[model samples]
Target chain A: MIDMLTNILQTTVLYSTPLILAAMGGLFSERSGVVNIGLEGLMTMGAFIAAITSLSTGNPWIGLIAAMIAGVILALPHAVAAITFKADQVVIGVAINFLALGLSVYLVKFMYDAGQTPTVQKKLEAVAIPGLSKIPILGPSIFQASPFTYIAIVVVILSYIILYKTTFGMRLRAVGEHPHAAETAGISVIAMRYTAVLISGALAAIGGACLSISIGSEFNQGTVAGQGFIALAALIFGKWNPFGALGAATFFGFAVALSLMGQLIGLSKYVPSEVLSMLPYVLTIIALASFVGRAVAPSALGKPFEKGSR
Target chain B: MSQLNKQSTIVTALISIFLAMIIGSIAMQVAGYNPFAAYQALFVGSLFQAFDLGETIRTTTPLILTGLAVAIAFRTGLFNIGVEGQMIVAQLASLLVGIKLNLPPVLHMIVAVLVGGIAGAIWGFIPGFLKAVRGVNEVIICIMMNFIALYLSNVLVRNWLSEQGTDSTPKIPESASLRVDFLSEMFDSSRVHLGIIIALIMAFVMYILLWKTKRGYELRAVGYNPSAAEYAGINVKRNIILSMVISGFFAGLAGAGELLGTQGYMAIQSAFTGIGFDGIAVALLGANTPIGVILAALLFGVLTYGSQNMEHVAQVPPELIRVVVAAIIFFVAANISGILLGAVKKKRRAKES
Candidate 1:
């Protein structure tokens, strides 16, 4: 029983790491007043690029960096459209997702003559902490993880600190809450928003890299498979807080792990596997419907910050 | 001024399409393919070829309804991203009714189609109610709902609806089928059917509902400014729900068009048909107008239908068409007209000075 519990816990962390990273990215963007539905596409690009780079260079870290760059590059168009041109943020986000989907598939087909890239030569290997990974349950579950999992944990901590304990964080929040006021206070709303959005893209890319190089070890047509959107849902369920996002993502990850385990343990004979697979989405809907009204957004979230406009 | 605005919008849409084609050509060239030859093949396959034209129209049938689904929701200030989910649910509902019932031909068809609409409306109502009553973001809820609907439909198909040795339900009864003999004959025995006619009629109905009815005015008013509409005695909450229901209704019809007209049965979908996501592009390119949706759907139809020929003749990847569609969506959603019109007005002012 203890062994089974440890295994399940390990699986949960593995599943949640990407979601935590992406949700943290979403937290920064939304807390800074931008709605980023393009995380899905950004992750797709990251996963594809990471797989290709890791496959070629035989190094997952380099692939991770390349994934972040690809993400930022893809995000530039969204920034230009939503911030510079004042397009509807949601519409621009939808377009970006479509663009990412098409561009990645097109590139893959062009490069590999297939819909997916070849599996990476080097995947991010699990790191067993000295002496810690041997502990009965807690150690193995927490200490034996890929470098990306540790990085995701660090990111969640750093995001919380940056968002709640820094001057820049305060300014970002101010810009999100009231851009006009932020501008009156001499803050450059456009620059702040641009920075936040770019950070979001970078972090989401890292999450994508985690999926392709760490979890799946390859970039397929379904590598990112709505994980970005699931991360978005986690961000919303977590009320846009880094810690909240972490908890929500872990819960979703647990749900996913349970579904897999249930199927493995022959629970599918009793409860249909499809229903188990749907647990996370159903939970997200319930969480959103229950909390959205109470969990207030940044006052100026999704509104374009125009200079000299009240 | 309205006429000039309309003209400018059209010009901007054309420019966007032109830019996408240019980019697509460059991509083709980079891939060691001939762009002009690929485009020629695309045009011939989608337009000049008789059977392909029928295929284009056949593809256009579902797109028109889905586009209208998105368009109606957009006009009412709701983003119904769950059109795909609603359509899936509707497809299942239509399949169940179409296969289970043994009614006479016309009544059975109508009943199947109506059941699809009702099922979609119910699927749509959840997010709408959550958004209206609980202030949840409809986009997120809709996204979640889509996964739920997908899994639910998968379970249903696997356990209850699946025919022996196949992942599809049994063929719908002839009475429930939307295949029209004359229409198929007209299209050179292609898959064209009564669905296109129904789609066109729905477009007309949408136009009339949106522009010629008081409920539409209320919906639009609520969309434009909910607080103001509420102050002016419009039921904002009710309109939100109503708009979603209507949007889902159209989405349901889209599913019926596919199941009854094209496929004659529901197959378990491994992935989304992408018709719903494409509807976002269709609605945007059409400027959320009913007639514009038809035109935009036809354009998309040509691209998708033509892609096969492009692949066969020029060895261009069909995925390139998707890239082109994405570019078109980006340009349109970014308000290409706003920049061009501003440039044009500046030029005029300079000339006057």
Candidate 2:
């Protein structure tokens, strides 16, 4: 039973890392006043580029960097359209998702003559922390994992600090809550929003890199598999707070792990795998419906700020 | 000025399409393919042949319904991303009714289609209710509901509805089928059915409902400004839910069209049909107008059906069609033509002053 518990805990962490990273990314963007429905596309770009770069360079770290850069590049058009042109953010987001799906598949087919890339030569490997890893359940679940797992945890902490404990974070929140006021206070709303969105892209890309390099070990059409949306849900469920998103993501990861465990334990005979797969989504709806009333959004979220406009 | 505004919108859509074609050509060139030949093959494959045109019409049938589905919701200020989910649920419901019913042919088909719409309404109602009552973001709720619907449908198909070795349900009885003898014969025995006529009628109904009815006025008013509409005595919450139900009703019809007109059976979908997602593009290109949806749906149908021949004759990847479609959407969403028109308007204003 202890062994089974440990195994499940390990799987949960593995599953939650990407969600945590992406949700944290979403937290930043939403808190800074922009609604980013393009996280999925950004992640897709990151996963594809990360896989290709890791395969060619034989360096996972280099691939991770490439993934972040690719994410930022993909986000540029969304930023330009949403911020500068003041296009509908949701429409731009949906279009970006479609574009990413098409572009990635086209690139994969072009490069590999197939719909997915070959397994990378260099993948982010598990690092067993020397002293901490020897501890029973907590150690194996938290300390002994991929470097990306540690990075994800650090990201959560850093996000908390950056969002709640810093001047930039305060200005970002101010901009999200009331861009006009932020501007009156001499804060550059556009620049703050741009920075926030760019950070979101970078973090979301790292999440994608974690998927291709650490979890899946290859880039396929399904590598991102609605995980980005799940992250978005976690963000909403967490009320757009970094630590809250981290906890929500971990909860979802636990649900996913439980589904996998059900298969292993022959629970499939009683409950279909498809039904099990519905758990996280169903929970998301319930959580949103139940918590959204209390969880207020940034007052100026999804609204475009024009200079000297009320 | 209203006429000019409409003309500018059309011009913008046309420009976006033109620019997308250029982008596609550039991509083809980079990929070492002949763009002109590929486009030529695409046109010929979809338009020149009678049978191919029939295939295009058949494909257009579902797109018309789904496009209207998204368009209606958009007009009501709701983003019904769960059209895909609602369609799947309705598809499954229609399949169940299609296979299980023992009524006369016409009544059975009507019943099956109605069941689909009702099932979709139920699916759509969840998120709508959540949004109306709980203030949950409809987009997130709809997105979640989509996954739930997908997984639930797959389970239902696999455990209860699956035929012997295949993952699909048994062929739906002829009584529930929408196939029409004369239509198929006219199309060189293609899978074309009466669903196209139904879709056209629905488009007309949509036009009448949106423009000629009080309920539609209420819906539109609520969509434009819910708080103001509420102050003006419209039931904003009710309209929000009603809009989603109506949207889901059409999405359900799209699913019925697929099952009755095209597939004839519910196969376990390994992935989303993408017709629902594509509906967003259709609605955007259509300017959320009923007549525009028909035209846009036809165009999308041609591109989808023609991509196969393009791949065969020109050796271009069919994925290029998707790339082109995405490019068009990018340009449209960014309102590239709107920007150009604004520039023009500004120059005119300066001269007038």
Candidate 3:
């Protein structure tokens, strides 16, 4: 029973890492009043870039950087369209999803003559912290884990600090709450939005890289499938707070972990594995509906900041 | 003002398409393929061959319904990303009805279609109701619902409808099928069916319903400005829910048409069939109008069908078309033509001075 519990807990942490990173990325963007529905696409590009670069360089760390750069490249267009051109963020975000998937797959097929990239030689394997690795169940699950897992936790703390303690974060929140007021207070709403979205892209891309290099050994079309949206759900369920998002992401990851291990745990005797797959999505709806009491979005969320207009 | 806006939209769509083509050509050049040859193959494969033309229409049939499904939702200020989920649920429901029910030919088909539509409406209702009552974001709910629908369909098929070892359900009887002899013979035995007629009719019905009826006016009014519509005594909540139901009805019909007409059974889907996502592009390119949707679906259908030929003949990846489609949508969403028009006006003014 203890072994099984440790296994489940380990799997939960493994699954939650990407969600935690991506949800934090979403927190930055949505908190700054931009609705970034294109995280899926950004992540897809990130996974593809990370896999390709890692394959070429035989270095997962370099691949991670390349993935971030690729994410910024993809996000530049979204930032331009949403912040500068004042396009409908949701619509453009959907388009970006399609573009990212299509472009990545197209490039993969073009270069590799296959639907997915070749698995890289280098992978971000788990490492054991000296003291904590000697502990009981918690050590293997939490302390002995991938560097990306540690990075994800660090990002959560950094995000909380960046969003609450800093002047930049205050200005960003002000812009999201009321762009006109932020403008009156001398904050450039456009610039703030651009920075937030770019940060979102970079972090979301890192989340994707974690999937490709750390959790999974390679990248394919399905590598980043639906995880980005789950991250989005985590962000909402967490009510746009970094710590809240971390808890929600870990909870979602636990659900996913349980579903994946249902048969081993004897849960599949009652529910079909396929039916088990619906748990996270169904829980998300229930969470969105009842769990979060009046989770309010930013005031200027999804609205273009028109200068000198009410 | 509306007339000029309509004209400008068409011009915008054309420019976007042109730019997308240029981008596609550049991509092709990078991939070391002949753009002209790929283009030639794409056009010729979809249009010149009679059988391919029939297949194009077969593809267009579902697209029409899904496009209309999305267009109507967009018209009502809701982004029905769940159309894919709605369609699949309807597909399963219609297939089950076709297999399980014992009825006369015409009645069976009608019952199956309606059953499918109602199933979709129910699926749509979950998110719509949540959005109306709890103020939940429909996009996230819709996305979640899609995965659920996918898993549910797979589970249902595996448990009840599967043929021993396969993941697919058994094919339904001929009485429930949409296959007809004359249309197939005309198109060199392609799987064209009465679904095309139904799709086209639905497009017209939607157009009239949106432009002609008081209910549609109310829906549009709420979409345009909810507070204003509420002040004007419209039931905003009902409209929101109704529009989603109607949108779901169209999506359900698309699924039914595909099952009863093109394919007669359901296979366990590992991923989405992408018809619903493509519908978004179709609606956007069509400007959310019925006529525009039809035209856009045709264009998309042509690209989809022709891209396979481009793959076979020019040795290019079929995913290139998706890139082109995405570029087109991005340009449209950004209103790229407005900037172009602004530049043109500035140039003309400079010349006059």
Candidate 4:
């Protein structure tokens, strides 16, 4: 029983890392007023590139960096088309998703001549803290894990601080809430939005790296598996706050963890796997549908902030 | 001076699409394939052979409905991202109606499509109601609904709807099947059905609804400015909900087109069901107009159908078509300001001169 409890916690922690990172990413973009529906494609693209790069180079860290760069590269056209041109953000986002799906497959086919790239070696497997290794259950459970796990928690704290305490974040919040007010106050709304969205891209890349180099270590087309949408849901349920996002992300993580747990305790046979998979989505719908009051997105979420428009 | 809008939005979109296809063909030529031959083969593989032409029309039928589905909602300012979900739910509903009862042909057909639309409309408005009343973001809600719909379809297929012959629902009854292969046999190679005709009729209806009618004007007015519409006596909340219901109707029709026109039955895990997601692109590429959506769908059908031959003959992955799609979208999206800037510059230069 203790082991099962520990296992579920462990699984939750593992699953939450990527969701946490991606939700933080989503927080950055949506908070900046750019609705980034392309995050799904972005994360999937990063995971594919990271896995292939790590396998090709045999360096997981290098793969991680490459994935970030790859994510930025993919984000460029989307940003240009969306931010600069004043094209519909949602339309461009949808296009980017399809583009990524097609382009990644094309690249994979070109380089490896196969449907998918090889699995990565030198994975960022879980590691125990040396001093804490000797302690009992809680110590082992709490103290030992992948470096990314710790980074995820640290990032949550850091994201909260950056979004709330920093002048840069203040400018972003101002831009999102009211562009005219921010502009009058000398905030470059477009620049602020750019910064937020780029950071969104970078943070999402880390989530992709976690999936590729730590959690799964293989390049599959469906690896991201709609976690980007989960992150988006988290952002909304969190009301665009970093702390609320953390809670929502953890809920999804726990739901996913339960599915894995069901496999271990002989519950998998009774419950349909598809039904289990639907739990997170069902929970999200129920949360979203209740509609107690307006969960106002950033006033500028999908409206492209053009220079001279205001 | 207004040539851009003069040609109509759909024509402008088609021009971009043409440019993109040309670029793709050039890419093929650069990669050492015979561009002319490949181009010819692309057309022939999709339209020249009877089965090929059937495939093209079949693919186009769903696109027409899904494209209009997206176009209608976008015009109403609600991004119905759950069209895929709506379509899936409707697919299951249509299948149940298609396979379960022992009704006559015409009754079953109407029941299947109508039930499908009702299922979709019911599923689509959850987010719409939330958005209208609670101020929730409809896009995120719709997207979440999509995931749920997919899983729900899987569950339905596994537990209840599994056909006696296979792990899916029983094939549509002989009364319900829309196989047009009988016509194809006349040509010695075809599978086209009457679904394309239905899709065209729906597109026409949508055109009238969007441009000529009172409710359509209300929907459009709400899309342009909801607060203003409210001030002018348009019930913004009602329009929003109505927009979603209308959107679901078209999406459901897309599912109907698929089942009645081609697949002869419905199953959850059959395909990725990209028609809904792809409909967004189609709508954008088509400029969210009915005629434009039809052309865009047909063009996509050609590209997808032709690319299969391109893959087999030229060793180029059919995924190359995606590059064209992405590039066109990029150009359409990324170059908007550039083109506007150019037009502005041209006007300025004329003034200076």
Candidate 5:
């Protein structure tokens, strides 16, 4: 029982790492009043770039950086369309997803002469903290994890600080809440939105890199499948708060961990594996409907800000 | 919301398509392929040969329905991303009905189709109900529901529907099948069936329903401006649910047509069929009209079926078609024609100054 508990906890944290990172990314963009439904695409680009770069350079760190850069590059069209062109953000997001999948898959086949990238030469390694490694059940699970887990935790804390404590954060929130009012106060709403969206792209891509480099060692069509949407769910369940999103991501991770490990732990005797596989998605719907209550979005969410119009 | 005139809408669509084609050519050049030859292969492969044309029509049939599914939702101010999931559930339902039911020939097919559509409506109703009553965002819920439907369908297929040692259900009964002998022979034994005729009929039905009916007027009003719709005494919640149900019904029918008309079995799928996702592109390109959806569906059908020929004949990857489609959607969403018009007007004013 103890061994199973430790295994579940460790795996849960592993699964949660990417979700936490992506949820934090989503929080920033949504807080800045741009509904970024393109996180999935951003993560796909990140995963593809991370694997390709890591394969070529034999350096996982460089791959991670490349992934972040790729995410920002991919997000440029979304930013231009949503902010400058004032296009429908949802439609732009859908287009982003299609473009990301198409471009990545096409390039992958072009470069590798295959549908998927080969495993990277170097992968991010798990690190075990010396002192914390001795703790009974918690030590191995919490102390030993991929570096992305630590990064995700740090991002959550940093997000909390940036969203609630800093002056820039205040202005960003103000812009999202009331762009006209923010403009009246001399804040550059467009700049804030652009910055937030770009940051979202970078962070979400890192989350994608976590999947390709940290957990898995390669990129494929399904490498970042649906995880980005799960992250979005986490952000919503977290009620757009930094720490709340982290907790929500962890819960989703736990659900996924349980589903994945249920067979290994001999729980599949009672439930079908397919049913187990559905746990996270079903839990999300239930959480959204009953537990999370009503999530109030940013006032300017999904709205194009006109300079002089209501 | 300012409605563009019909002429401008068509112009915008043409410009967007042209721009996307140019982008596709640039991408082909970057990838070391000849764009003209690749396009030629694609067009010829999908349209010129009888068998390929039949296959294109077969591929286009379900797309038309899914496109209509999405277009109706868009017209009613909803983004029905769950069409994919709804279709899956509907396929399962239709498969079961097609396999187990003992109804007579025509009745069995009708029953299977209706059951499939009803199943889809139920899937759609969840998100619609929540959005209508609880003020929830339908998009997120629809996405979540899609995953649930996918898993549920997989479980049902493997556990109950499939024959022993098989990953899919048994072939559906001939009574429930949509294949017609005459149509098959006309297309050189292609799988094209009655689904095309049904799809075209639905498109016209949808057009009449939206333009000539009072309920559709109310639905459109609610979509146009909910507050105004409420003030005008339209039941916004009911319309929301009704629109979703109607959209889901067609989504299910798309699945039924694919199964009963072509595949005739339910296989455990590892991933989405992508028809639903493509429906979004179709609706956008079609300008959310029935006639436009049919045209857009044909375009997508050509691209999808023709891409294989591009790969076989010109060594161009089939995935390039998706990039081309995405670029088209991007241009459409950005209203590239409007921007060009603005630029031209600015140049004229500069000359005057």
Candidate 6:
């Protein structure tokens, strides 16, 4: 029983990687007062572009970079509209999601000669650190994971430093919390917020690339599979803190892993895989119902930054 | 026109869209497809072809409801991202009831649609309650609800409902199904149905309620300035919950339009069809006004239908349509923001003047 639990935990770590990355991206955007409903779209776009890049260059690193670029590019519209245009951030975010899914799928059909990319043989190889992998059972599980898993951990620390510690972080948080006050302080609220949102796009793209090259090694139309929403949940559950979000991501990862384990153990053979697949979503709802934590988002979170508001 | 001194906002919007179009066209051309052909196909397929046009109206039915859902919530100052989830939950409820109940056509239809709408209201109300009572952000809560709805639907379908509890459910009774095909025979064998009429009526009704009714005024006032509204003796929280519930009612209808009016059955695929999310764009493009939602929904309907044809015939990636929609939304949002900014600038100038 212990071994079974341990093995399931390993799969959970793998499953949660993309979500942790995406949630961290969302934290950057939301912390800066931009509601990034576009996370899903950016992730999807990243997945498609990453697939293309990996296939083209036959290198996962290139795919990761390419996915980031694509994500930022997709997020450009949201930034321009929400920040520059001062449109409703939520609406712009929604449009980004739709545009991302539609554009990527349309491109795949046009470019790939099929709705899916050809499955590639070359994939990201998992590596284990010599000393760390042998530390213990937990050590083996943790160290013998993808490089991106470690990156996720590092980025969480980085996001915390960037969001709470640095001058730039101060400006981003200020703009989100009170753009008018931030403006008076000469923060260039618009500029800071735009930068935060763009960073969100870049990070979300990385998450998408991680999703494509790391696990699937191929991209399909709906590869994102609501991981973006899961990330959003993590952001909420974590109460906008990076470390908290990571823990939230892991919790969801466990939800996913447990469902897989549930079936493996024949815990509910009567239920189908699709039903099990919905478990994460069900957990998200139950989480909301329970009211996980106090969400004190930037005061001006959804307020369209209209220059004209009296 | 002069009274609207910021004709510049509209001009800016047009210019942005023009810029987006030129950019899209250039991108398409660079990708080796004739941009001219693509645009021609877009316009011709969307508006001119009888068959395509019919399909557009069919797609527009649920879109209008979803758009209204978003618009109503926005009017109350709530960003109801959970419309997708609410729509799903309501849809499942209607499907379940749709098969279980046996009644006359009118009563059955009312119960089927109304129950679904009520279910959506419950979903919307949860976030509304959170925002009102606890100060939780509706955006996050609604999103969470959407995920929950999706999963719950899957679980229910697989366990309790498939083949009487299968991945698929029994076909809705004929009495429960809306007569969506009454005009199909007249419309080139297209699926365009009476749901379009229902959507138009709902839009008109929404417009009247928002603009002409006392409750509408309260909802609008609360949306504009919640603190001021509370100070002025309005029950801000109640109004908010009411607004969200109203919007969810429409979202529920949107789901029913798909299940009962369009598909006449239920499937797990029915959940989170993006209509709830897409409705946000519709609400924004329409300016969250009732008339705006109707017009925007129709336009979206045209785009979707035309893209489907463009995909079948031209091998032009139908995704370009999504890019165009995104570009259009970007332009529209930018336009509104510009107007608001201009208003602020004018106020400052007025103070100076």
TM-score for chain B of each model, two decimals: 0.95, 0.95, 0.97, 0.88, 0.97, 0.88
User: Which regions of candidate 5 deviate over 4 angstroms?
Assistant: A291-295, B1-7, B349-353
Ranking by DockQ: 3, 5, 1, 2, 4, 6
Q: Judge candidate 5 at residue B16 and give its lDDT.
A: 89
What is the per-residue lDDT of model 5 for residues B220-248, given as tens digits with 9 covering 90 to 100?
89878889999999999999999999999
Q: Tell how far residue A13 is off in model 2, in angstroms.
A: 0.8
Backbone collisions counted per model = 0, 0, 0, 3, 0, 8
Candidate 6, B169-244: lDDT as tens digits: 7789878877645577667777776667778888998989999999999999998889999999999999999998
* Model 3 global lDDT (CA atoms, 0 to 1): 0.89
For lDDT, candidate 4 versus 5, the one ahead is: 5
Please report the TM-score between candidate 3 and the true structure: 0.98
> For model 4, what is the error of residue A157's alpha carbon versus the real structure, in angstroms, after optimal superposition?
1.7
lDDT (CA) per prediction: 0.87, 0.87, 0.89, 0.78, 0.89, 0.78
Model 6 chain B worst lDDT window (10 residues): B1-10
Per-residue C-alpha lDDT of model 5 across residues A76-157, encoded as one tens digit per residue: 8998898888877887888888888888999999999998999776799989999997898888888888999989988988
| Model 4: docking quality category | medium
In Å, residue A282's CA in model 1 sits off its true spot by: 1.5
lDDT of 4 by residue, A1-310 (tens): 8777777777888898888888888888888788888887788777887888888788887888888888787777777777777777877787777777777776677667787777777887777888885566555555787777888889899999988999988888888888878888888877787777777777787787888789996766667768878877777777788998899888888888877778678877899767777787777667766742344567777877756676
TM-score between model 4 and native: 0.93
Model 6 interface CAPRI class: medium
The candidate 1 chain B region of ten consecutive residues with least summed lDDT is B1-10
Q: Per-prediction RMSD in angstroms?
A: 1.9, 2.1, 1.6, 2.9, 1.5, 4.1
1 or 5, greater by TM-score: 5
Report the C-alpha displacement of residue B140, candidate 1, in angstroms: 1.5
Model 1 per-residue lDDT at A116: 83
TM-score of each: 0.97, 0.96, 0.98, 0.93, 0.98, 0.90
The candidate that wins on DockQ is: 3
Clashing pairs in 4: B50-B189, B50-B190, B163-B168
Residue-wise C-alpha lDDT for candidate 1, range B1-353, written one tens digit per residue: 11223465577678888888988898888888899999999989988856788889999998999999998999888998998999899999999889887899989999998999889889889999998899877888888888888889999999898988999888998899888788778778888878898899999999999899999999889877889999999999999999998999999999888888889877666678888888988988888888889999999999998999998998787889888998898887777656777799999999999
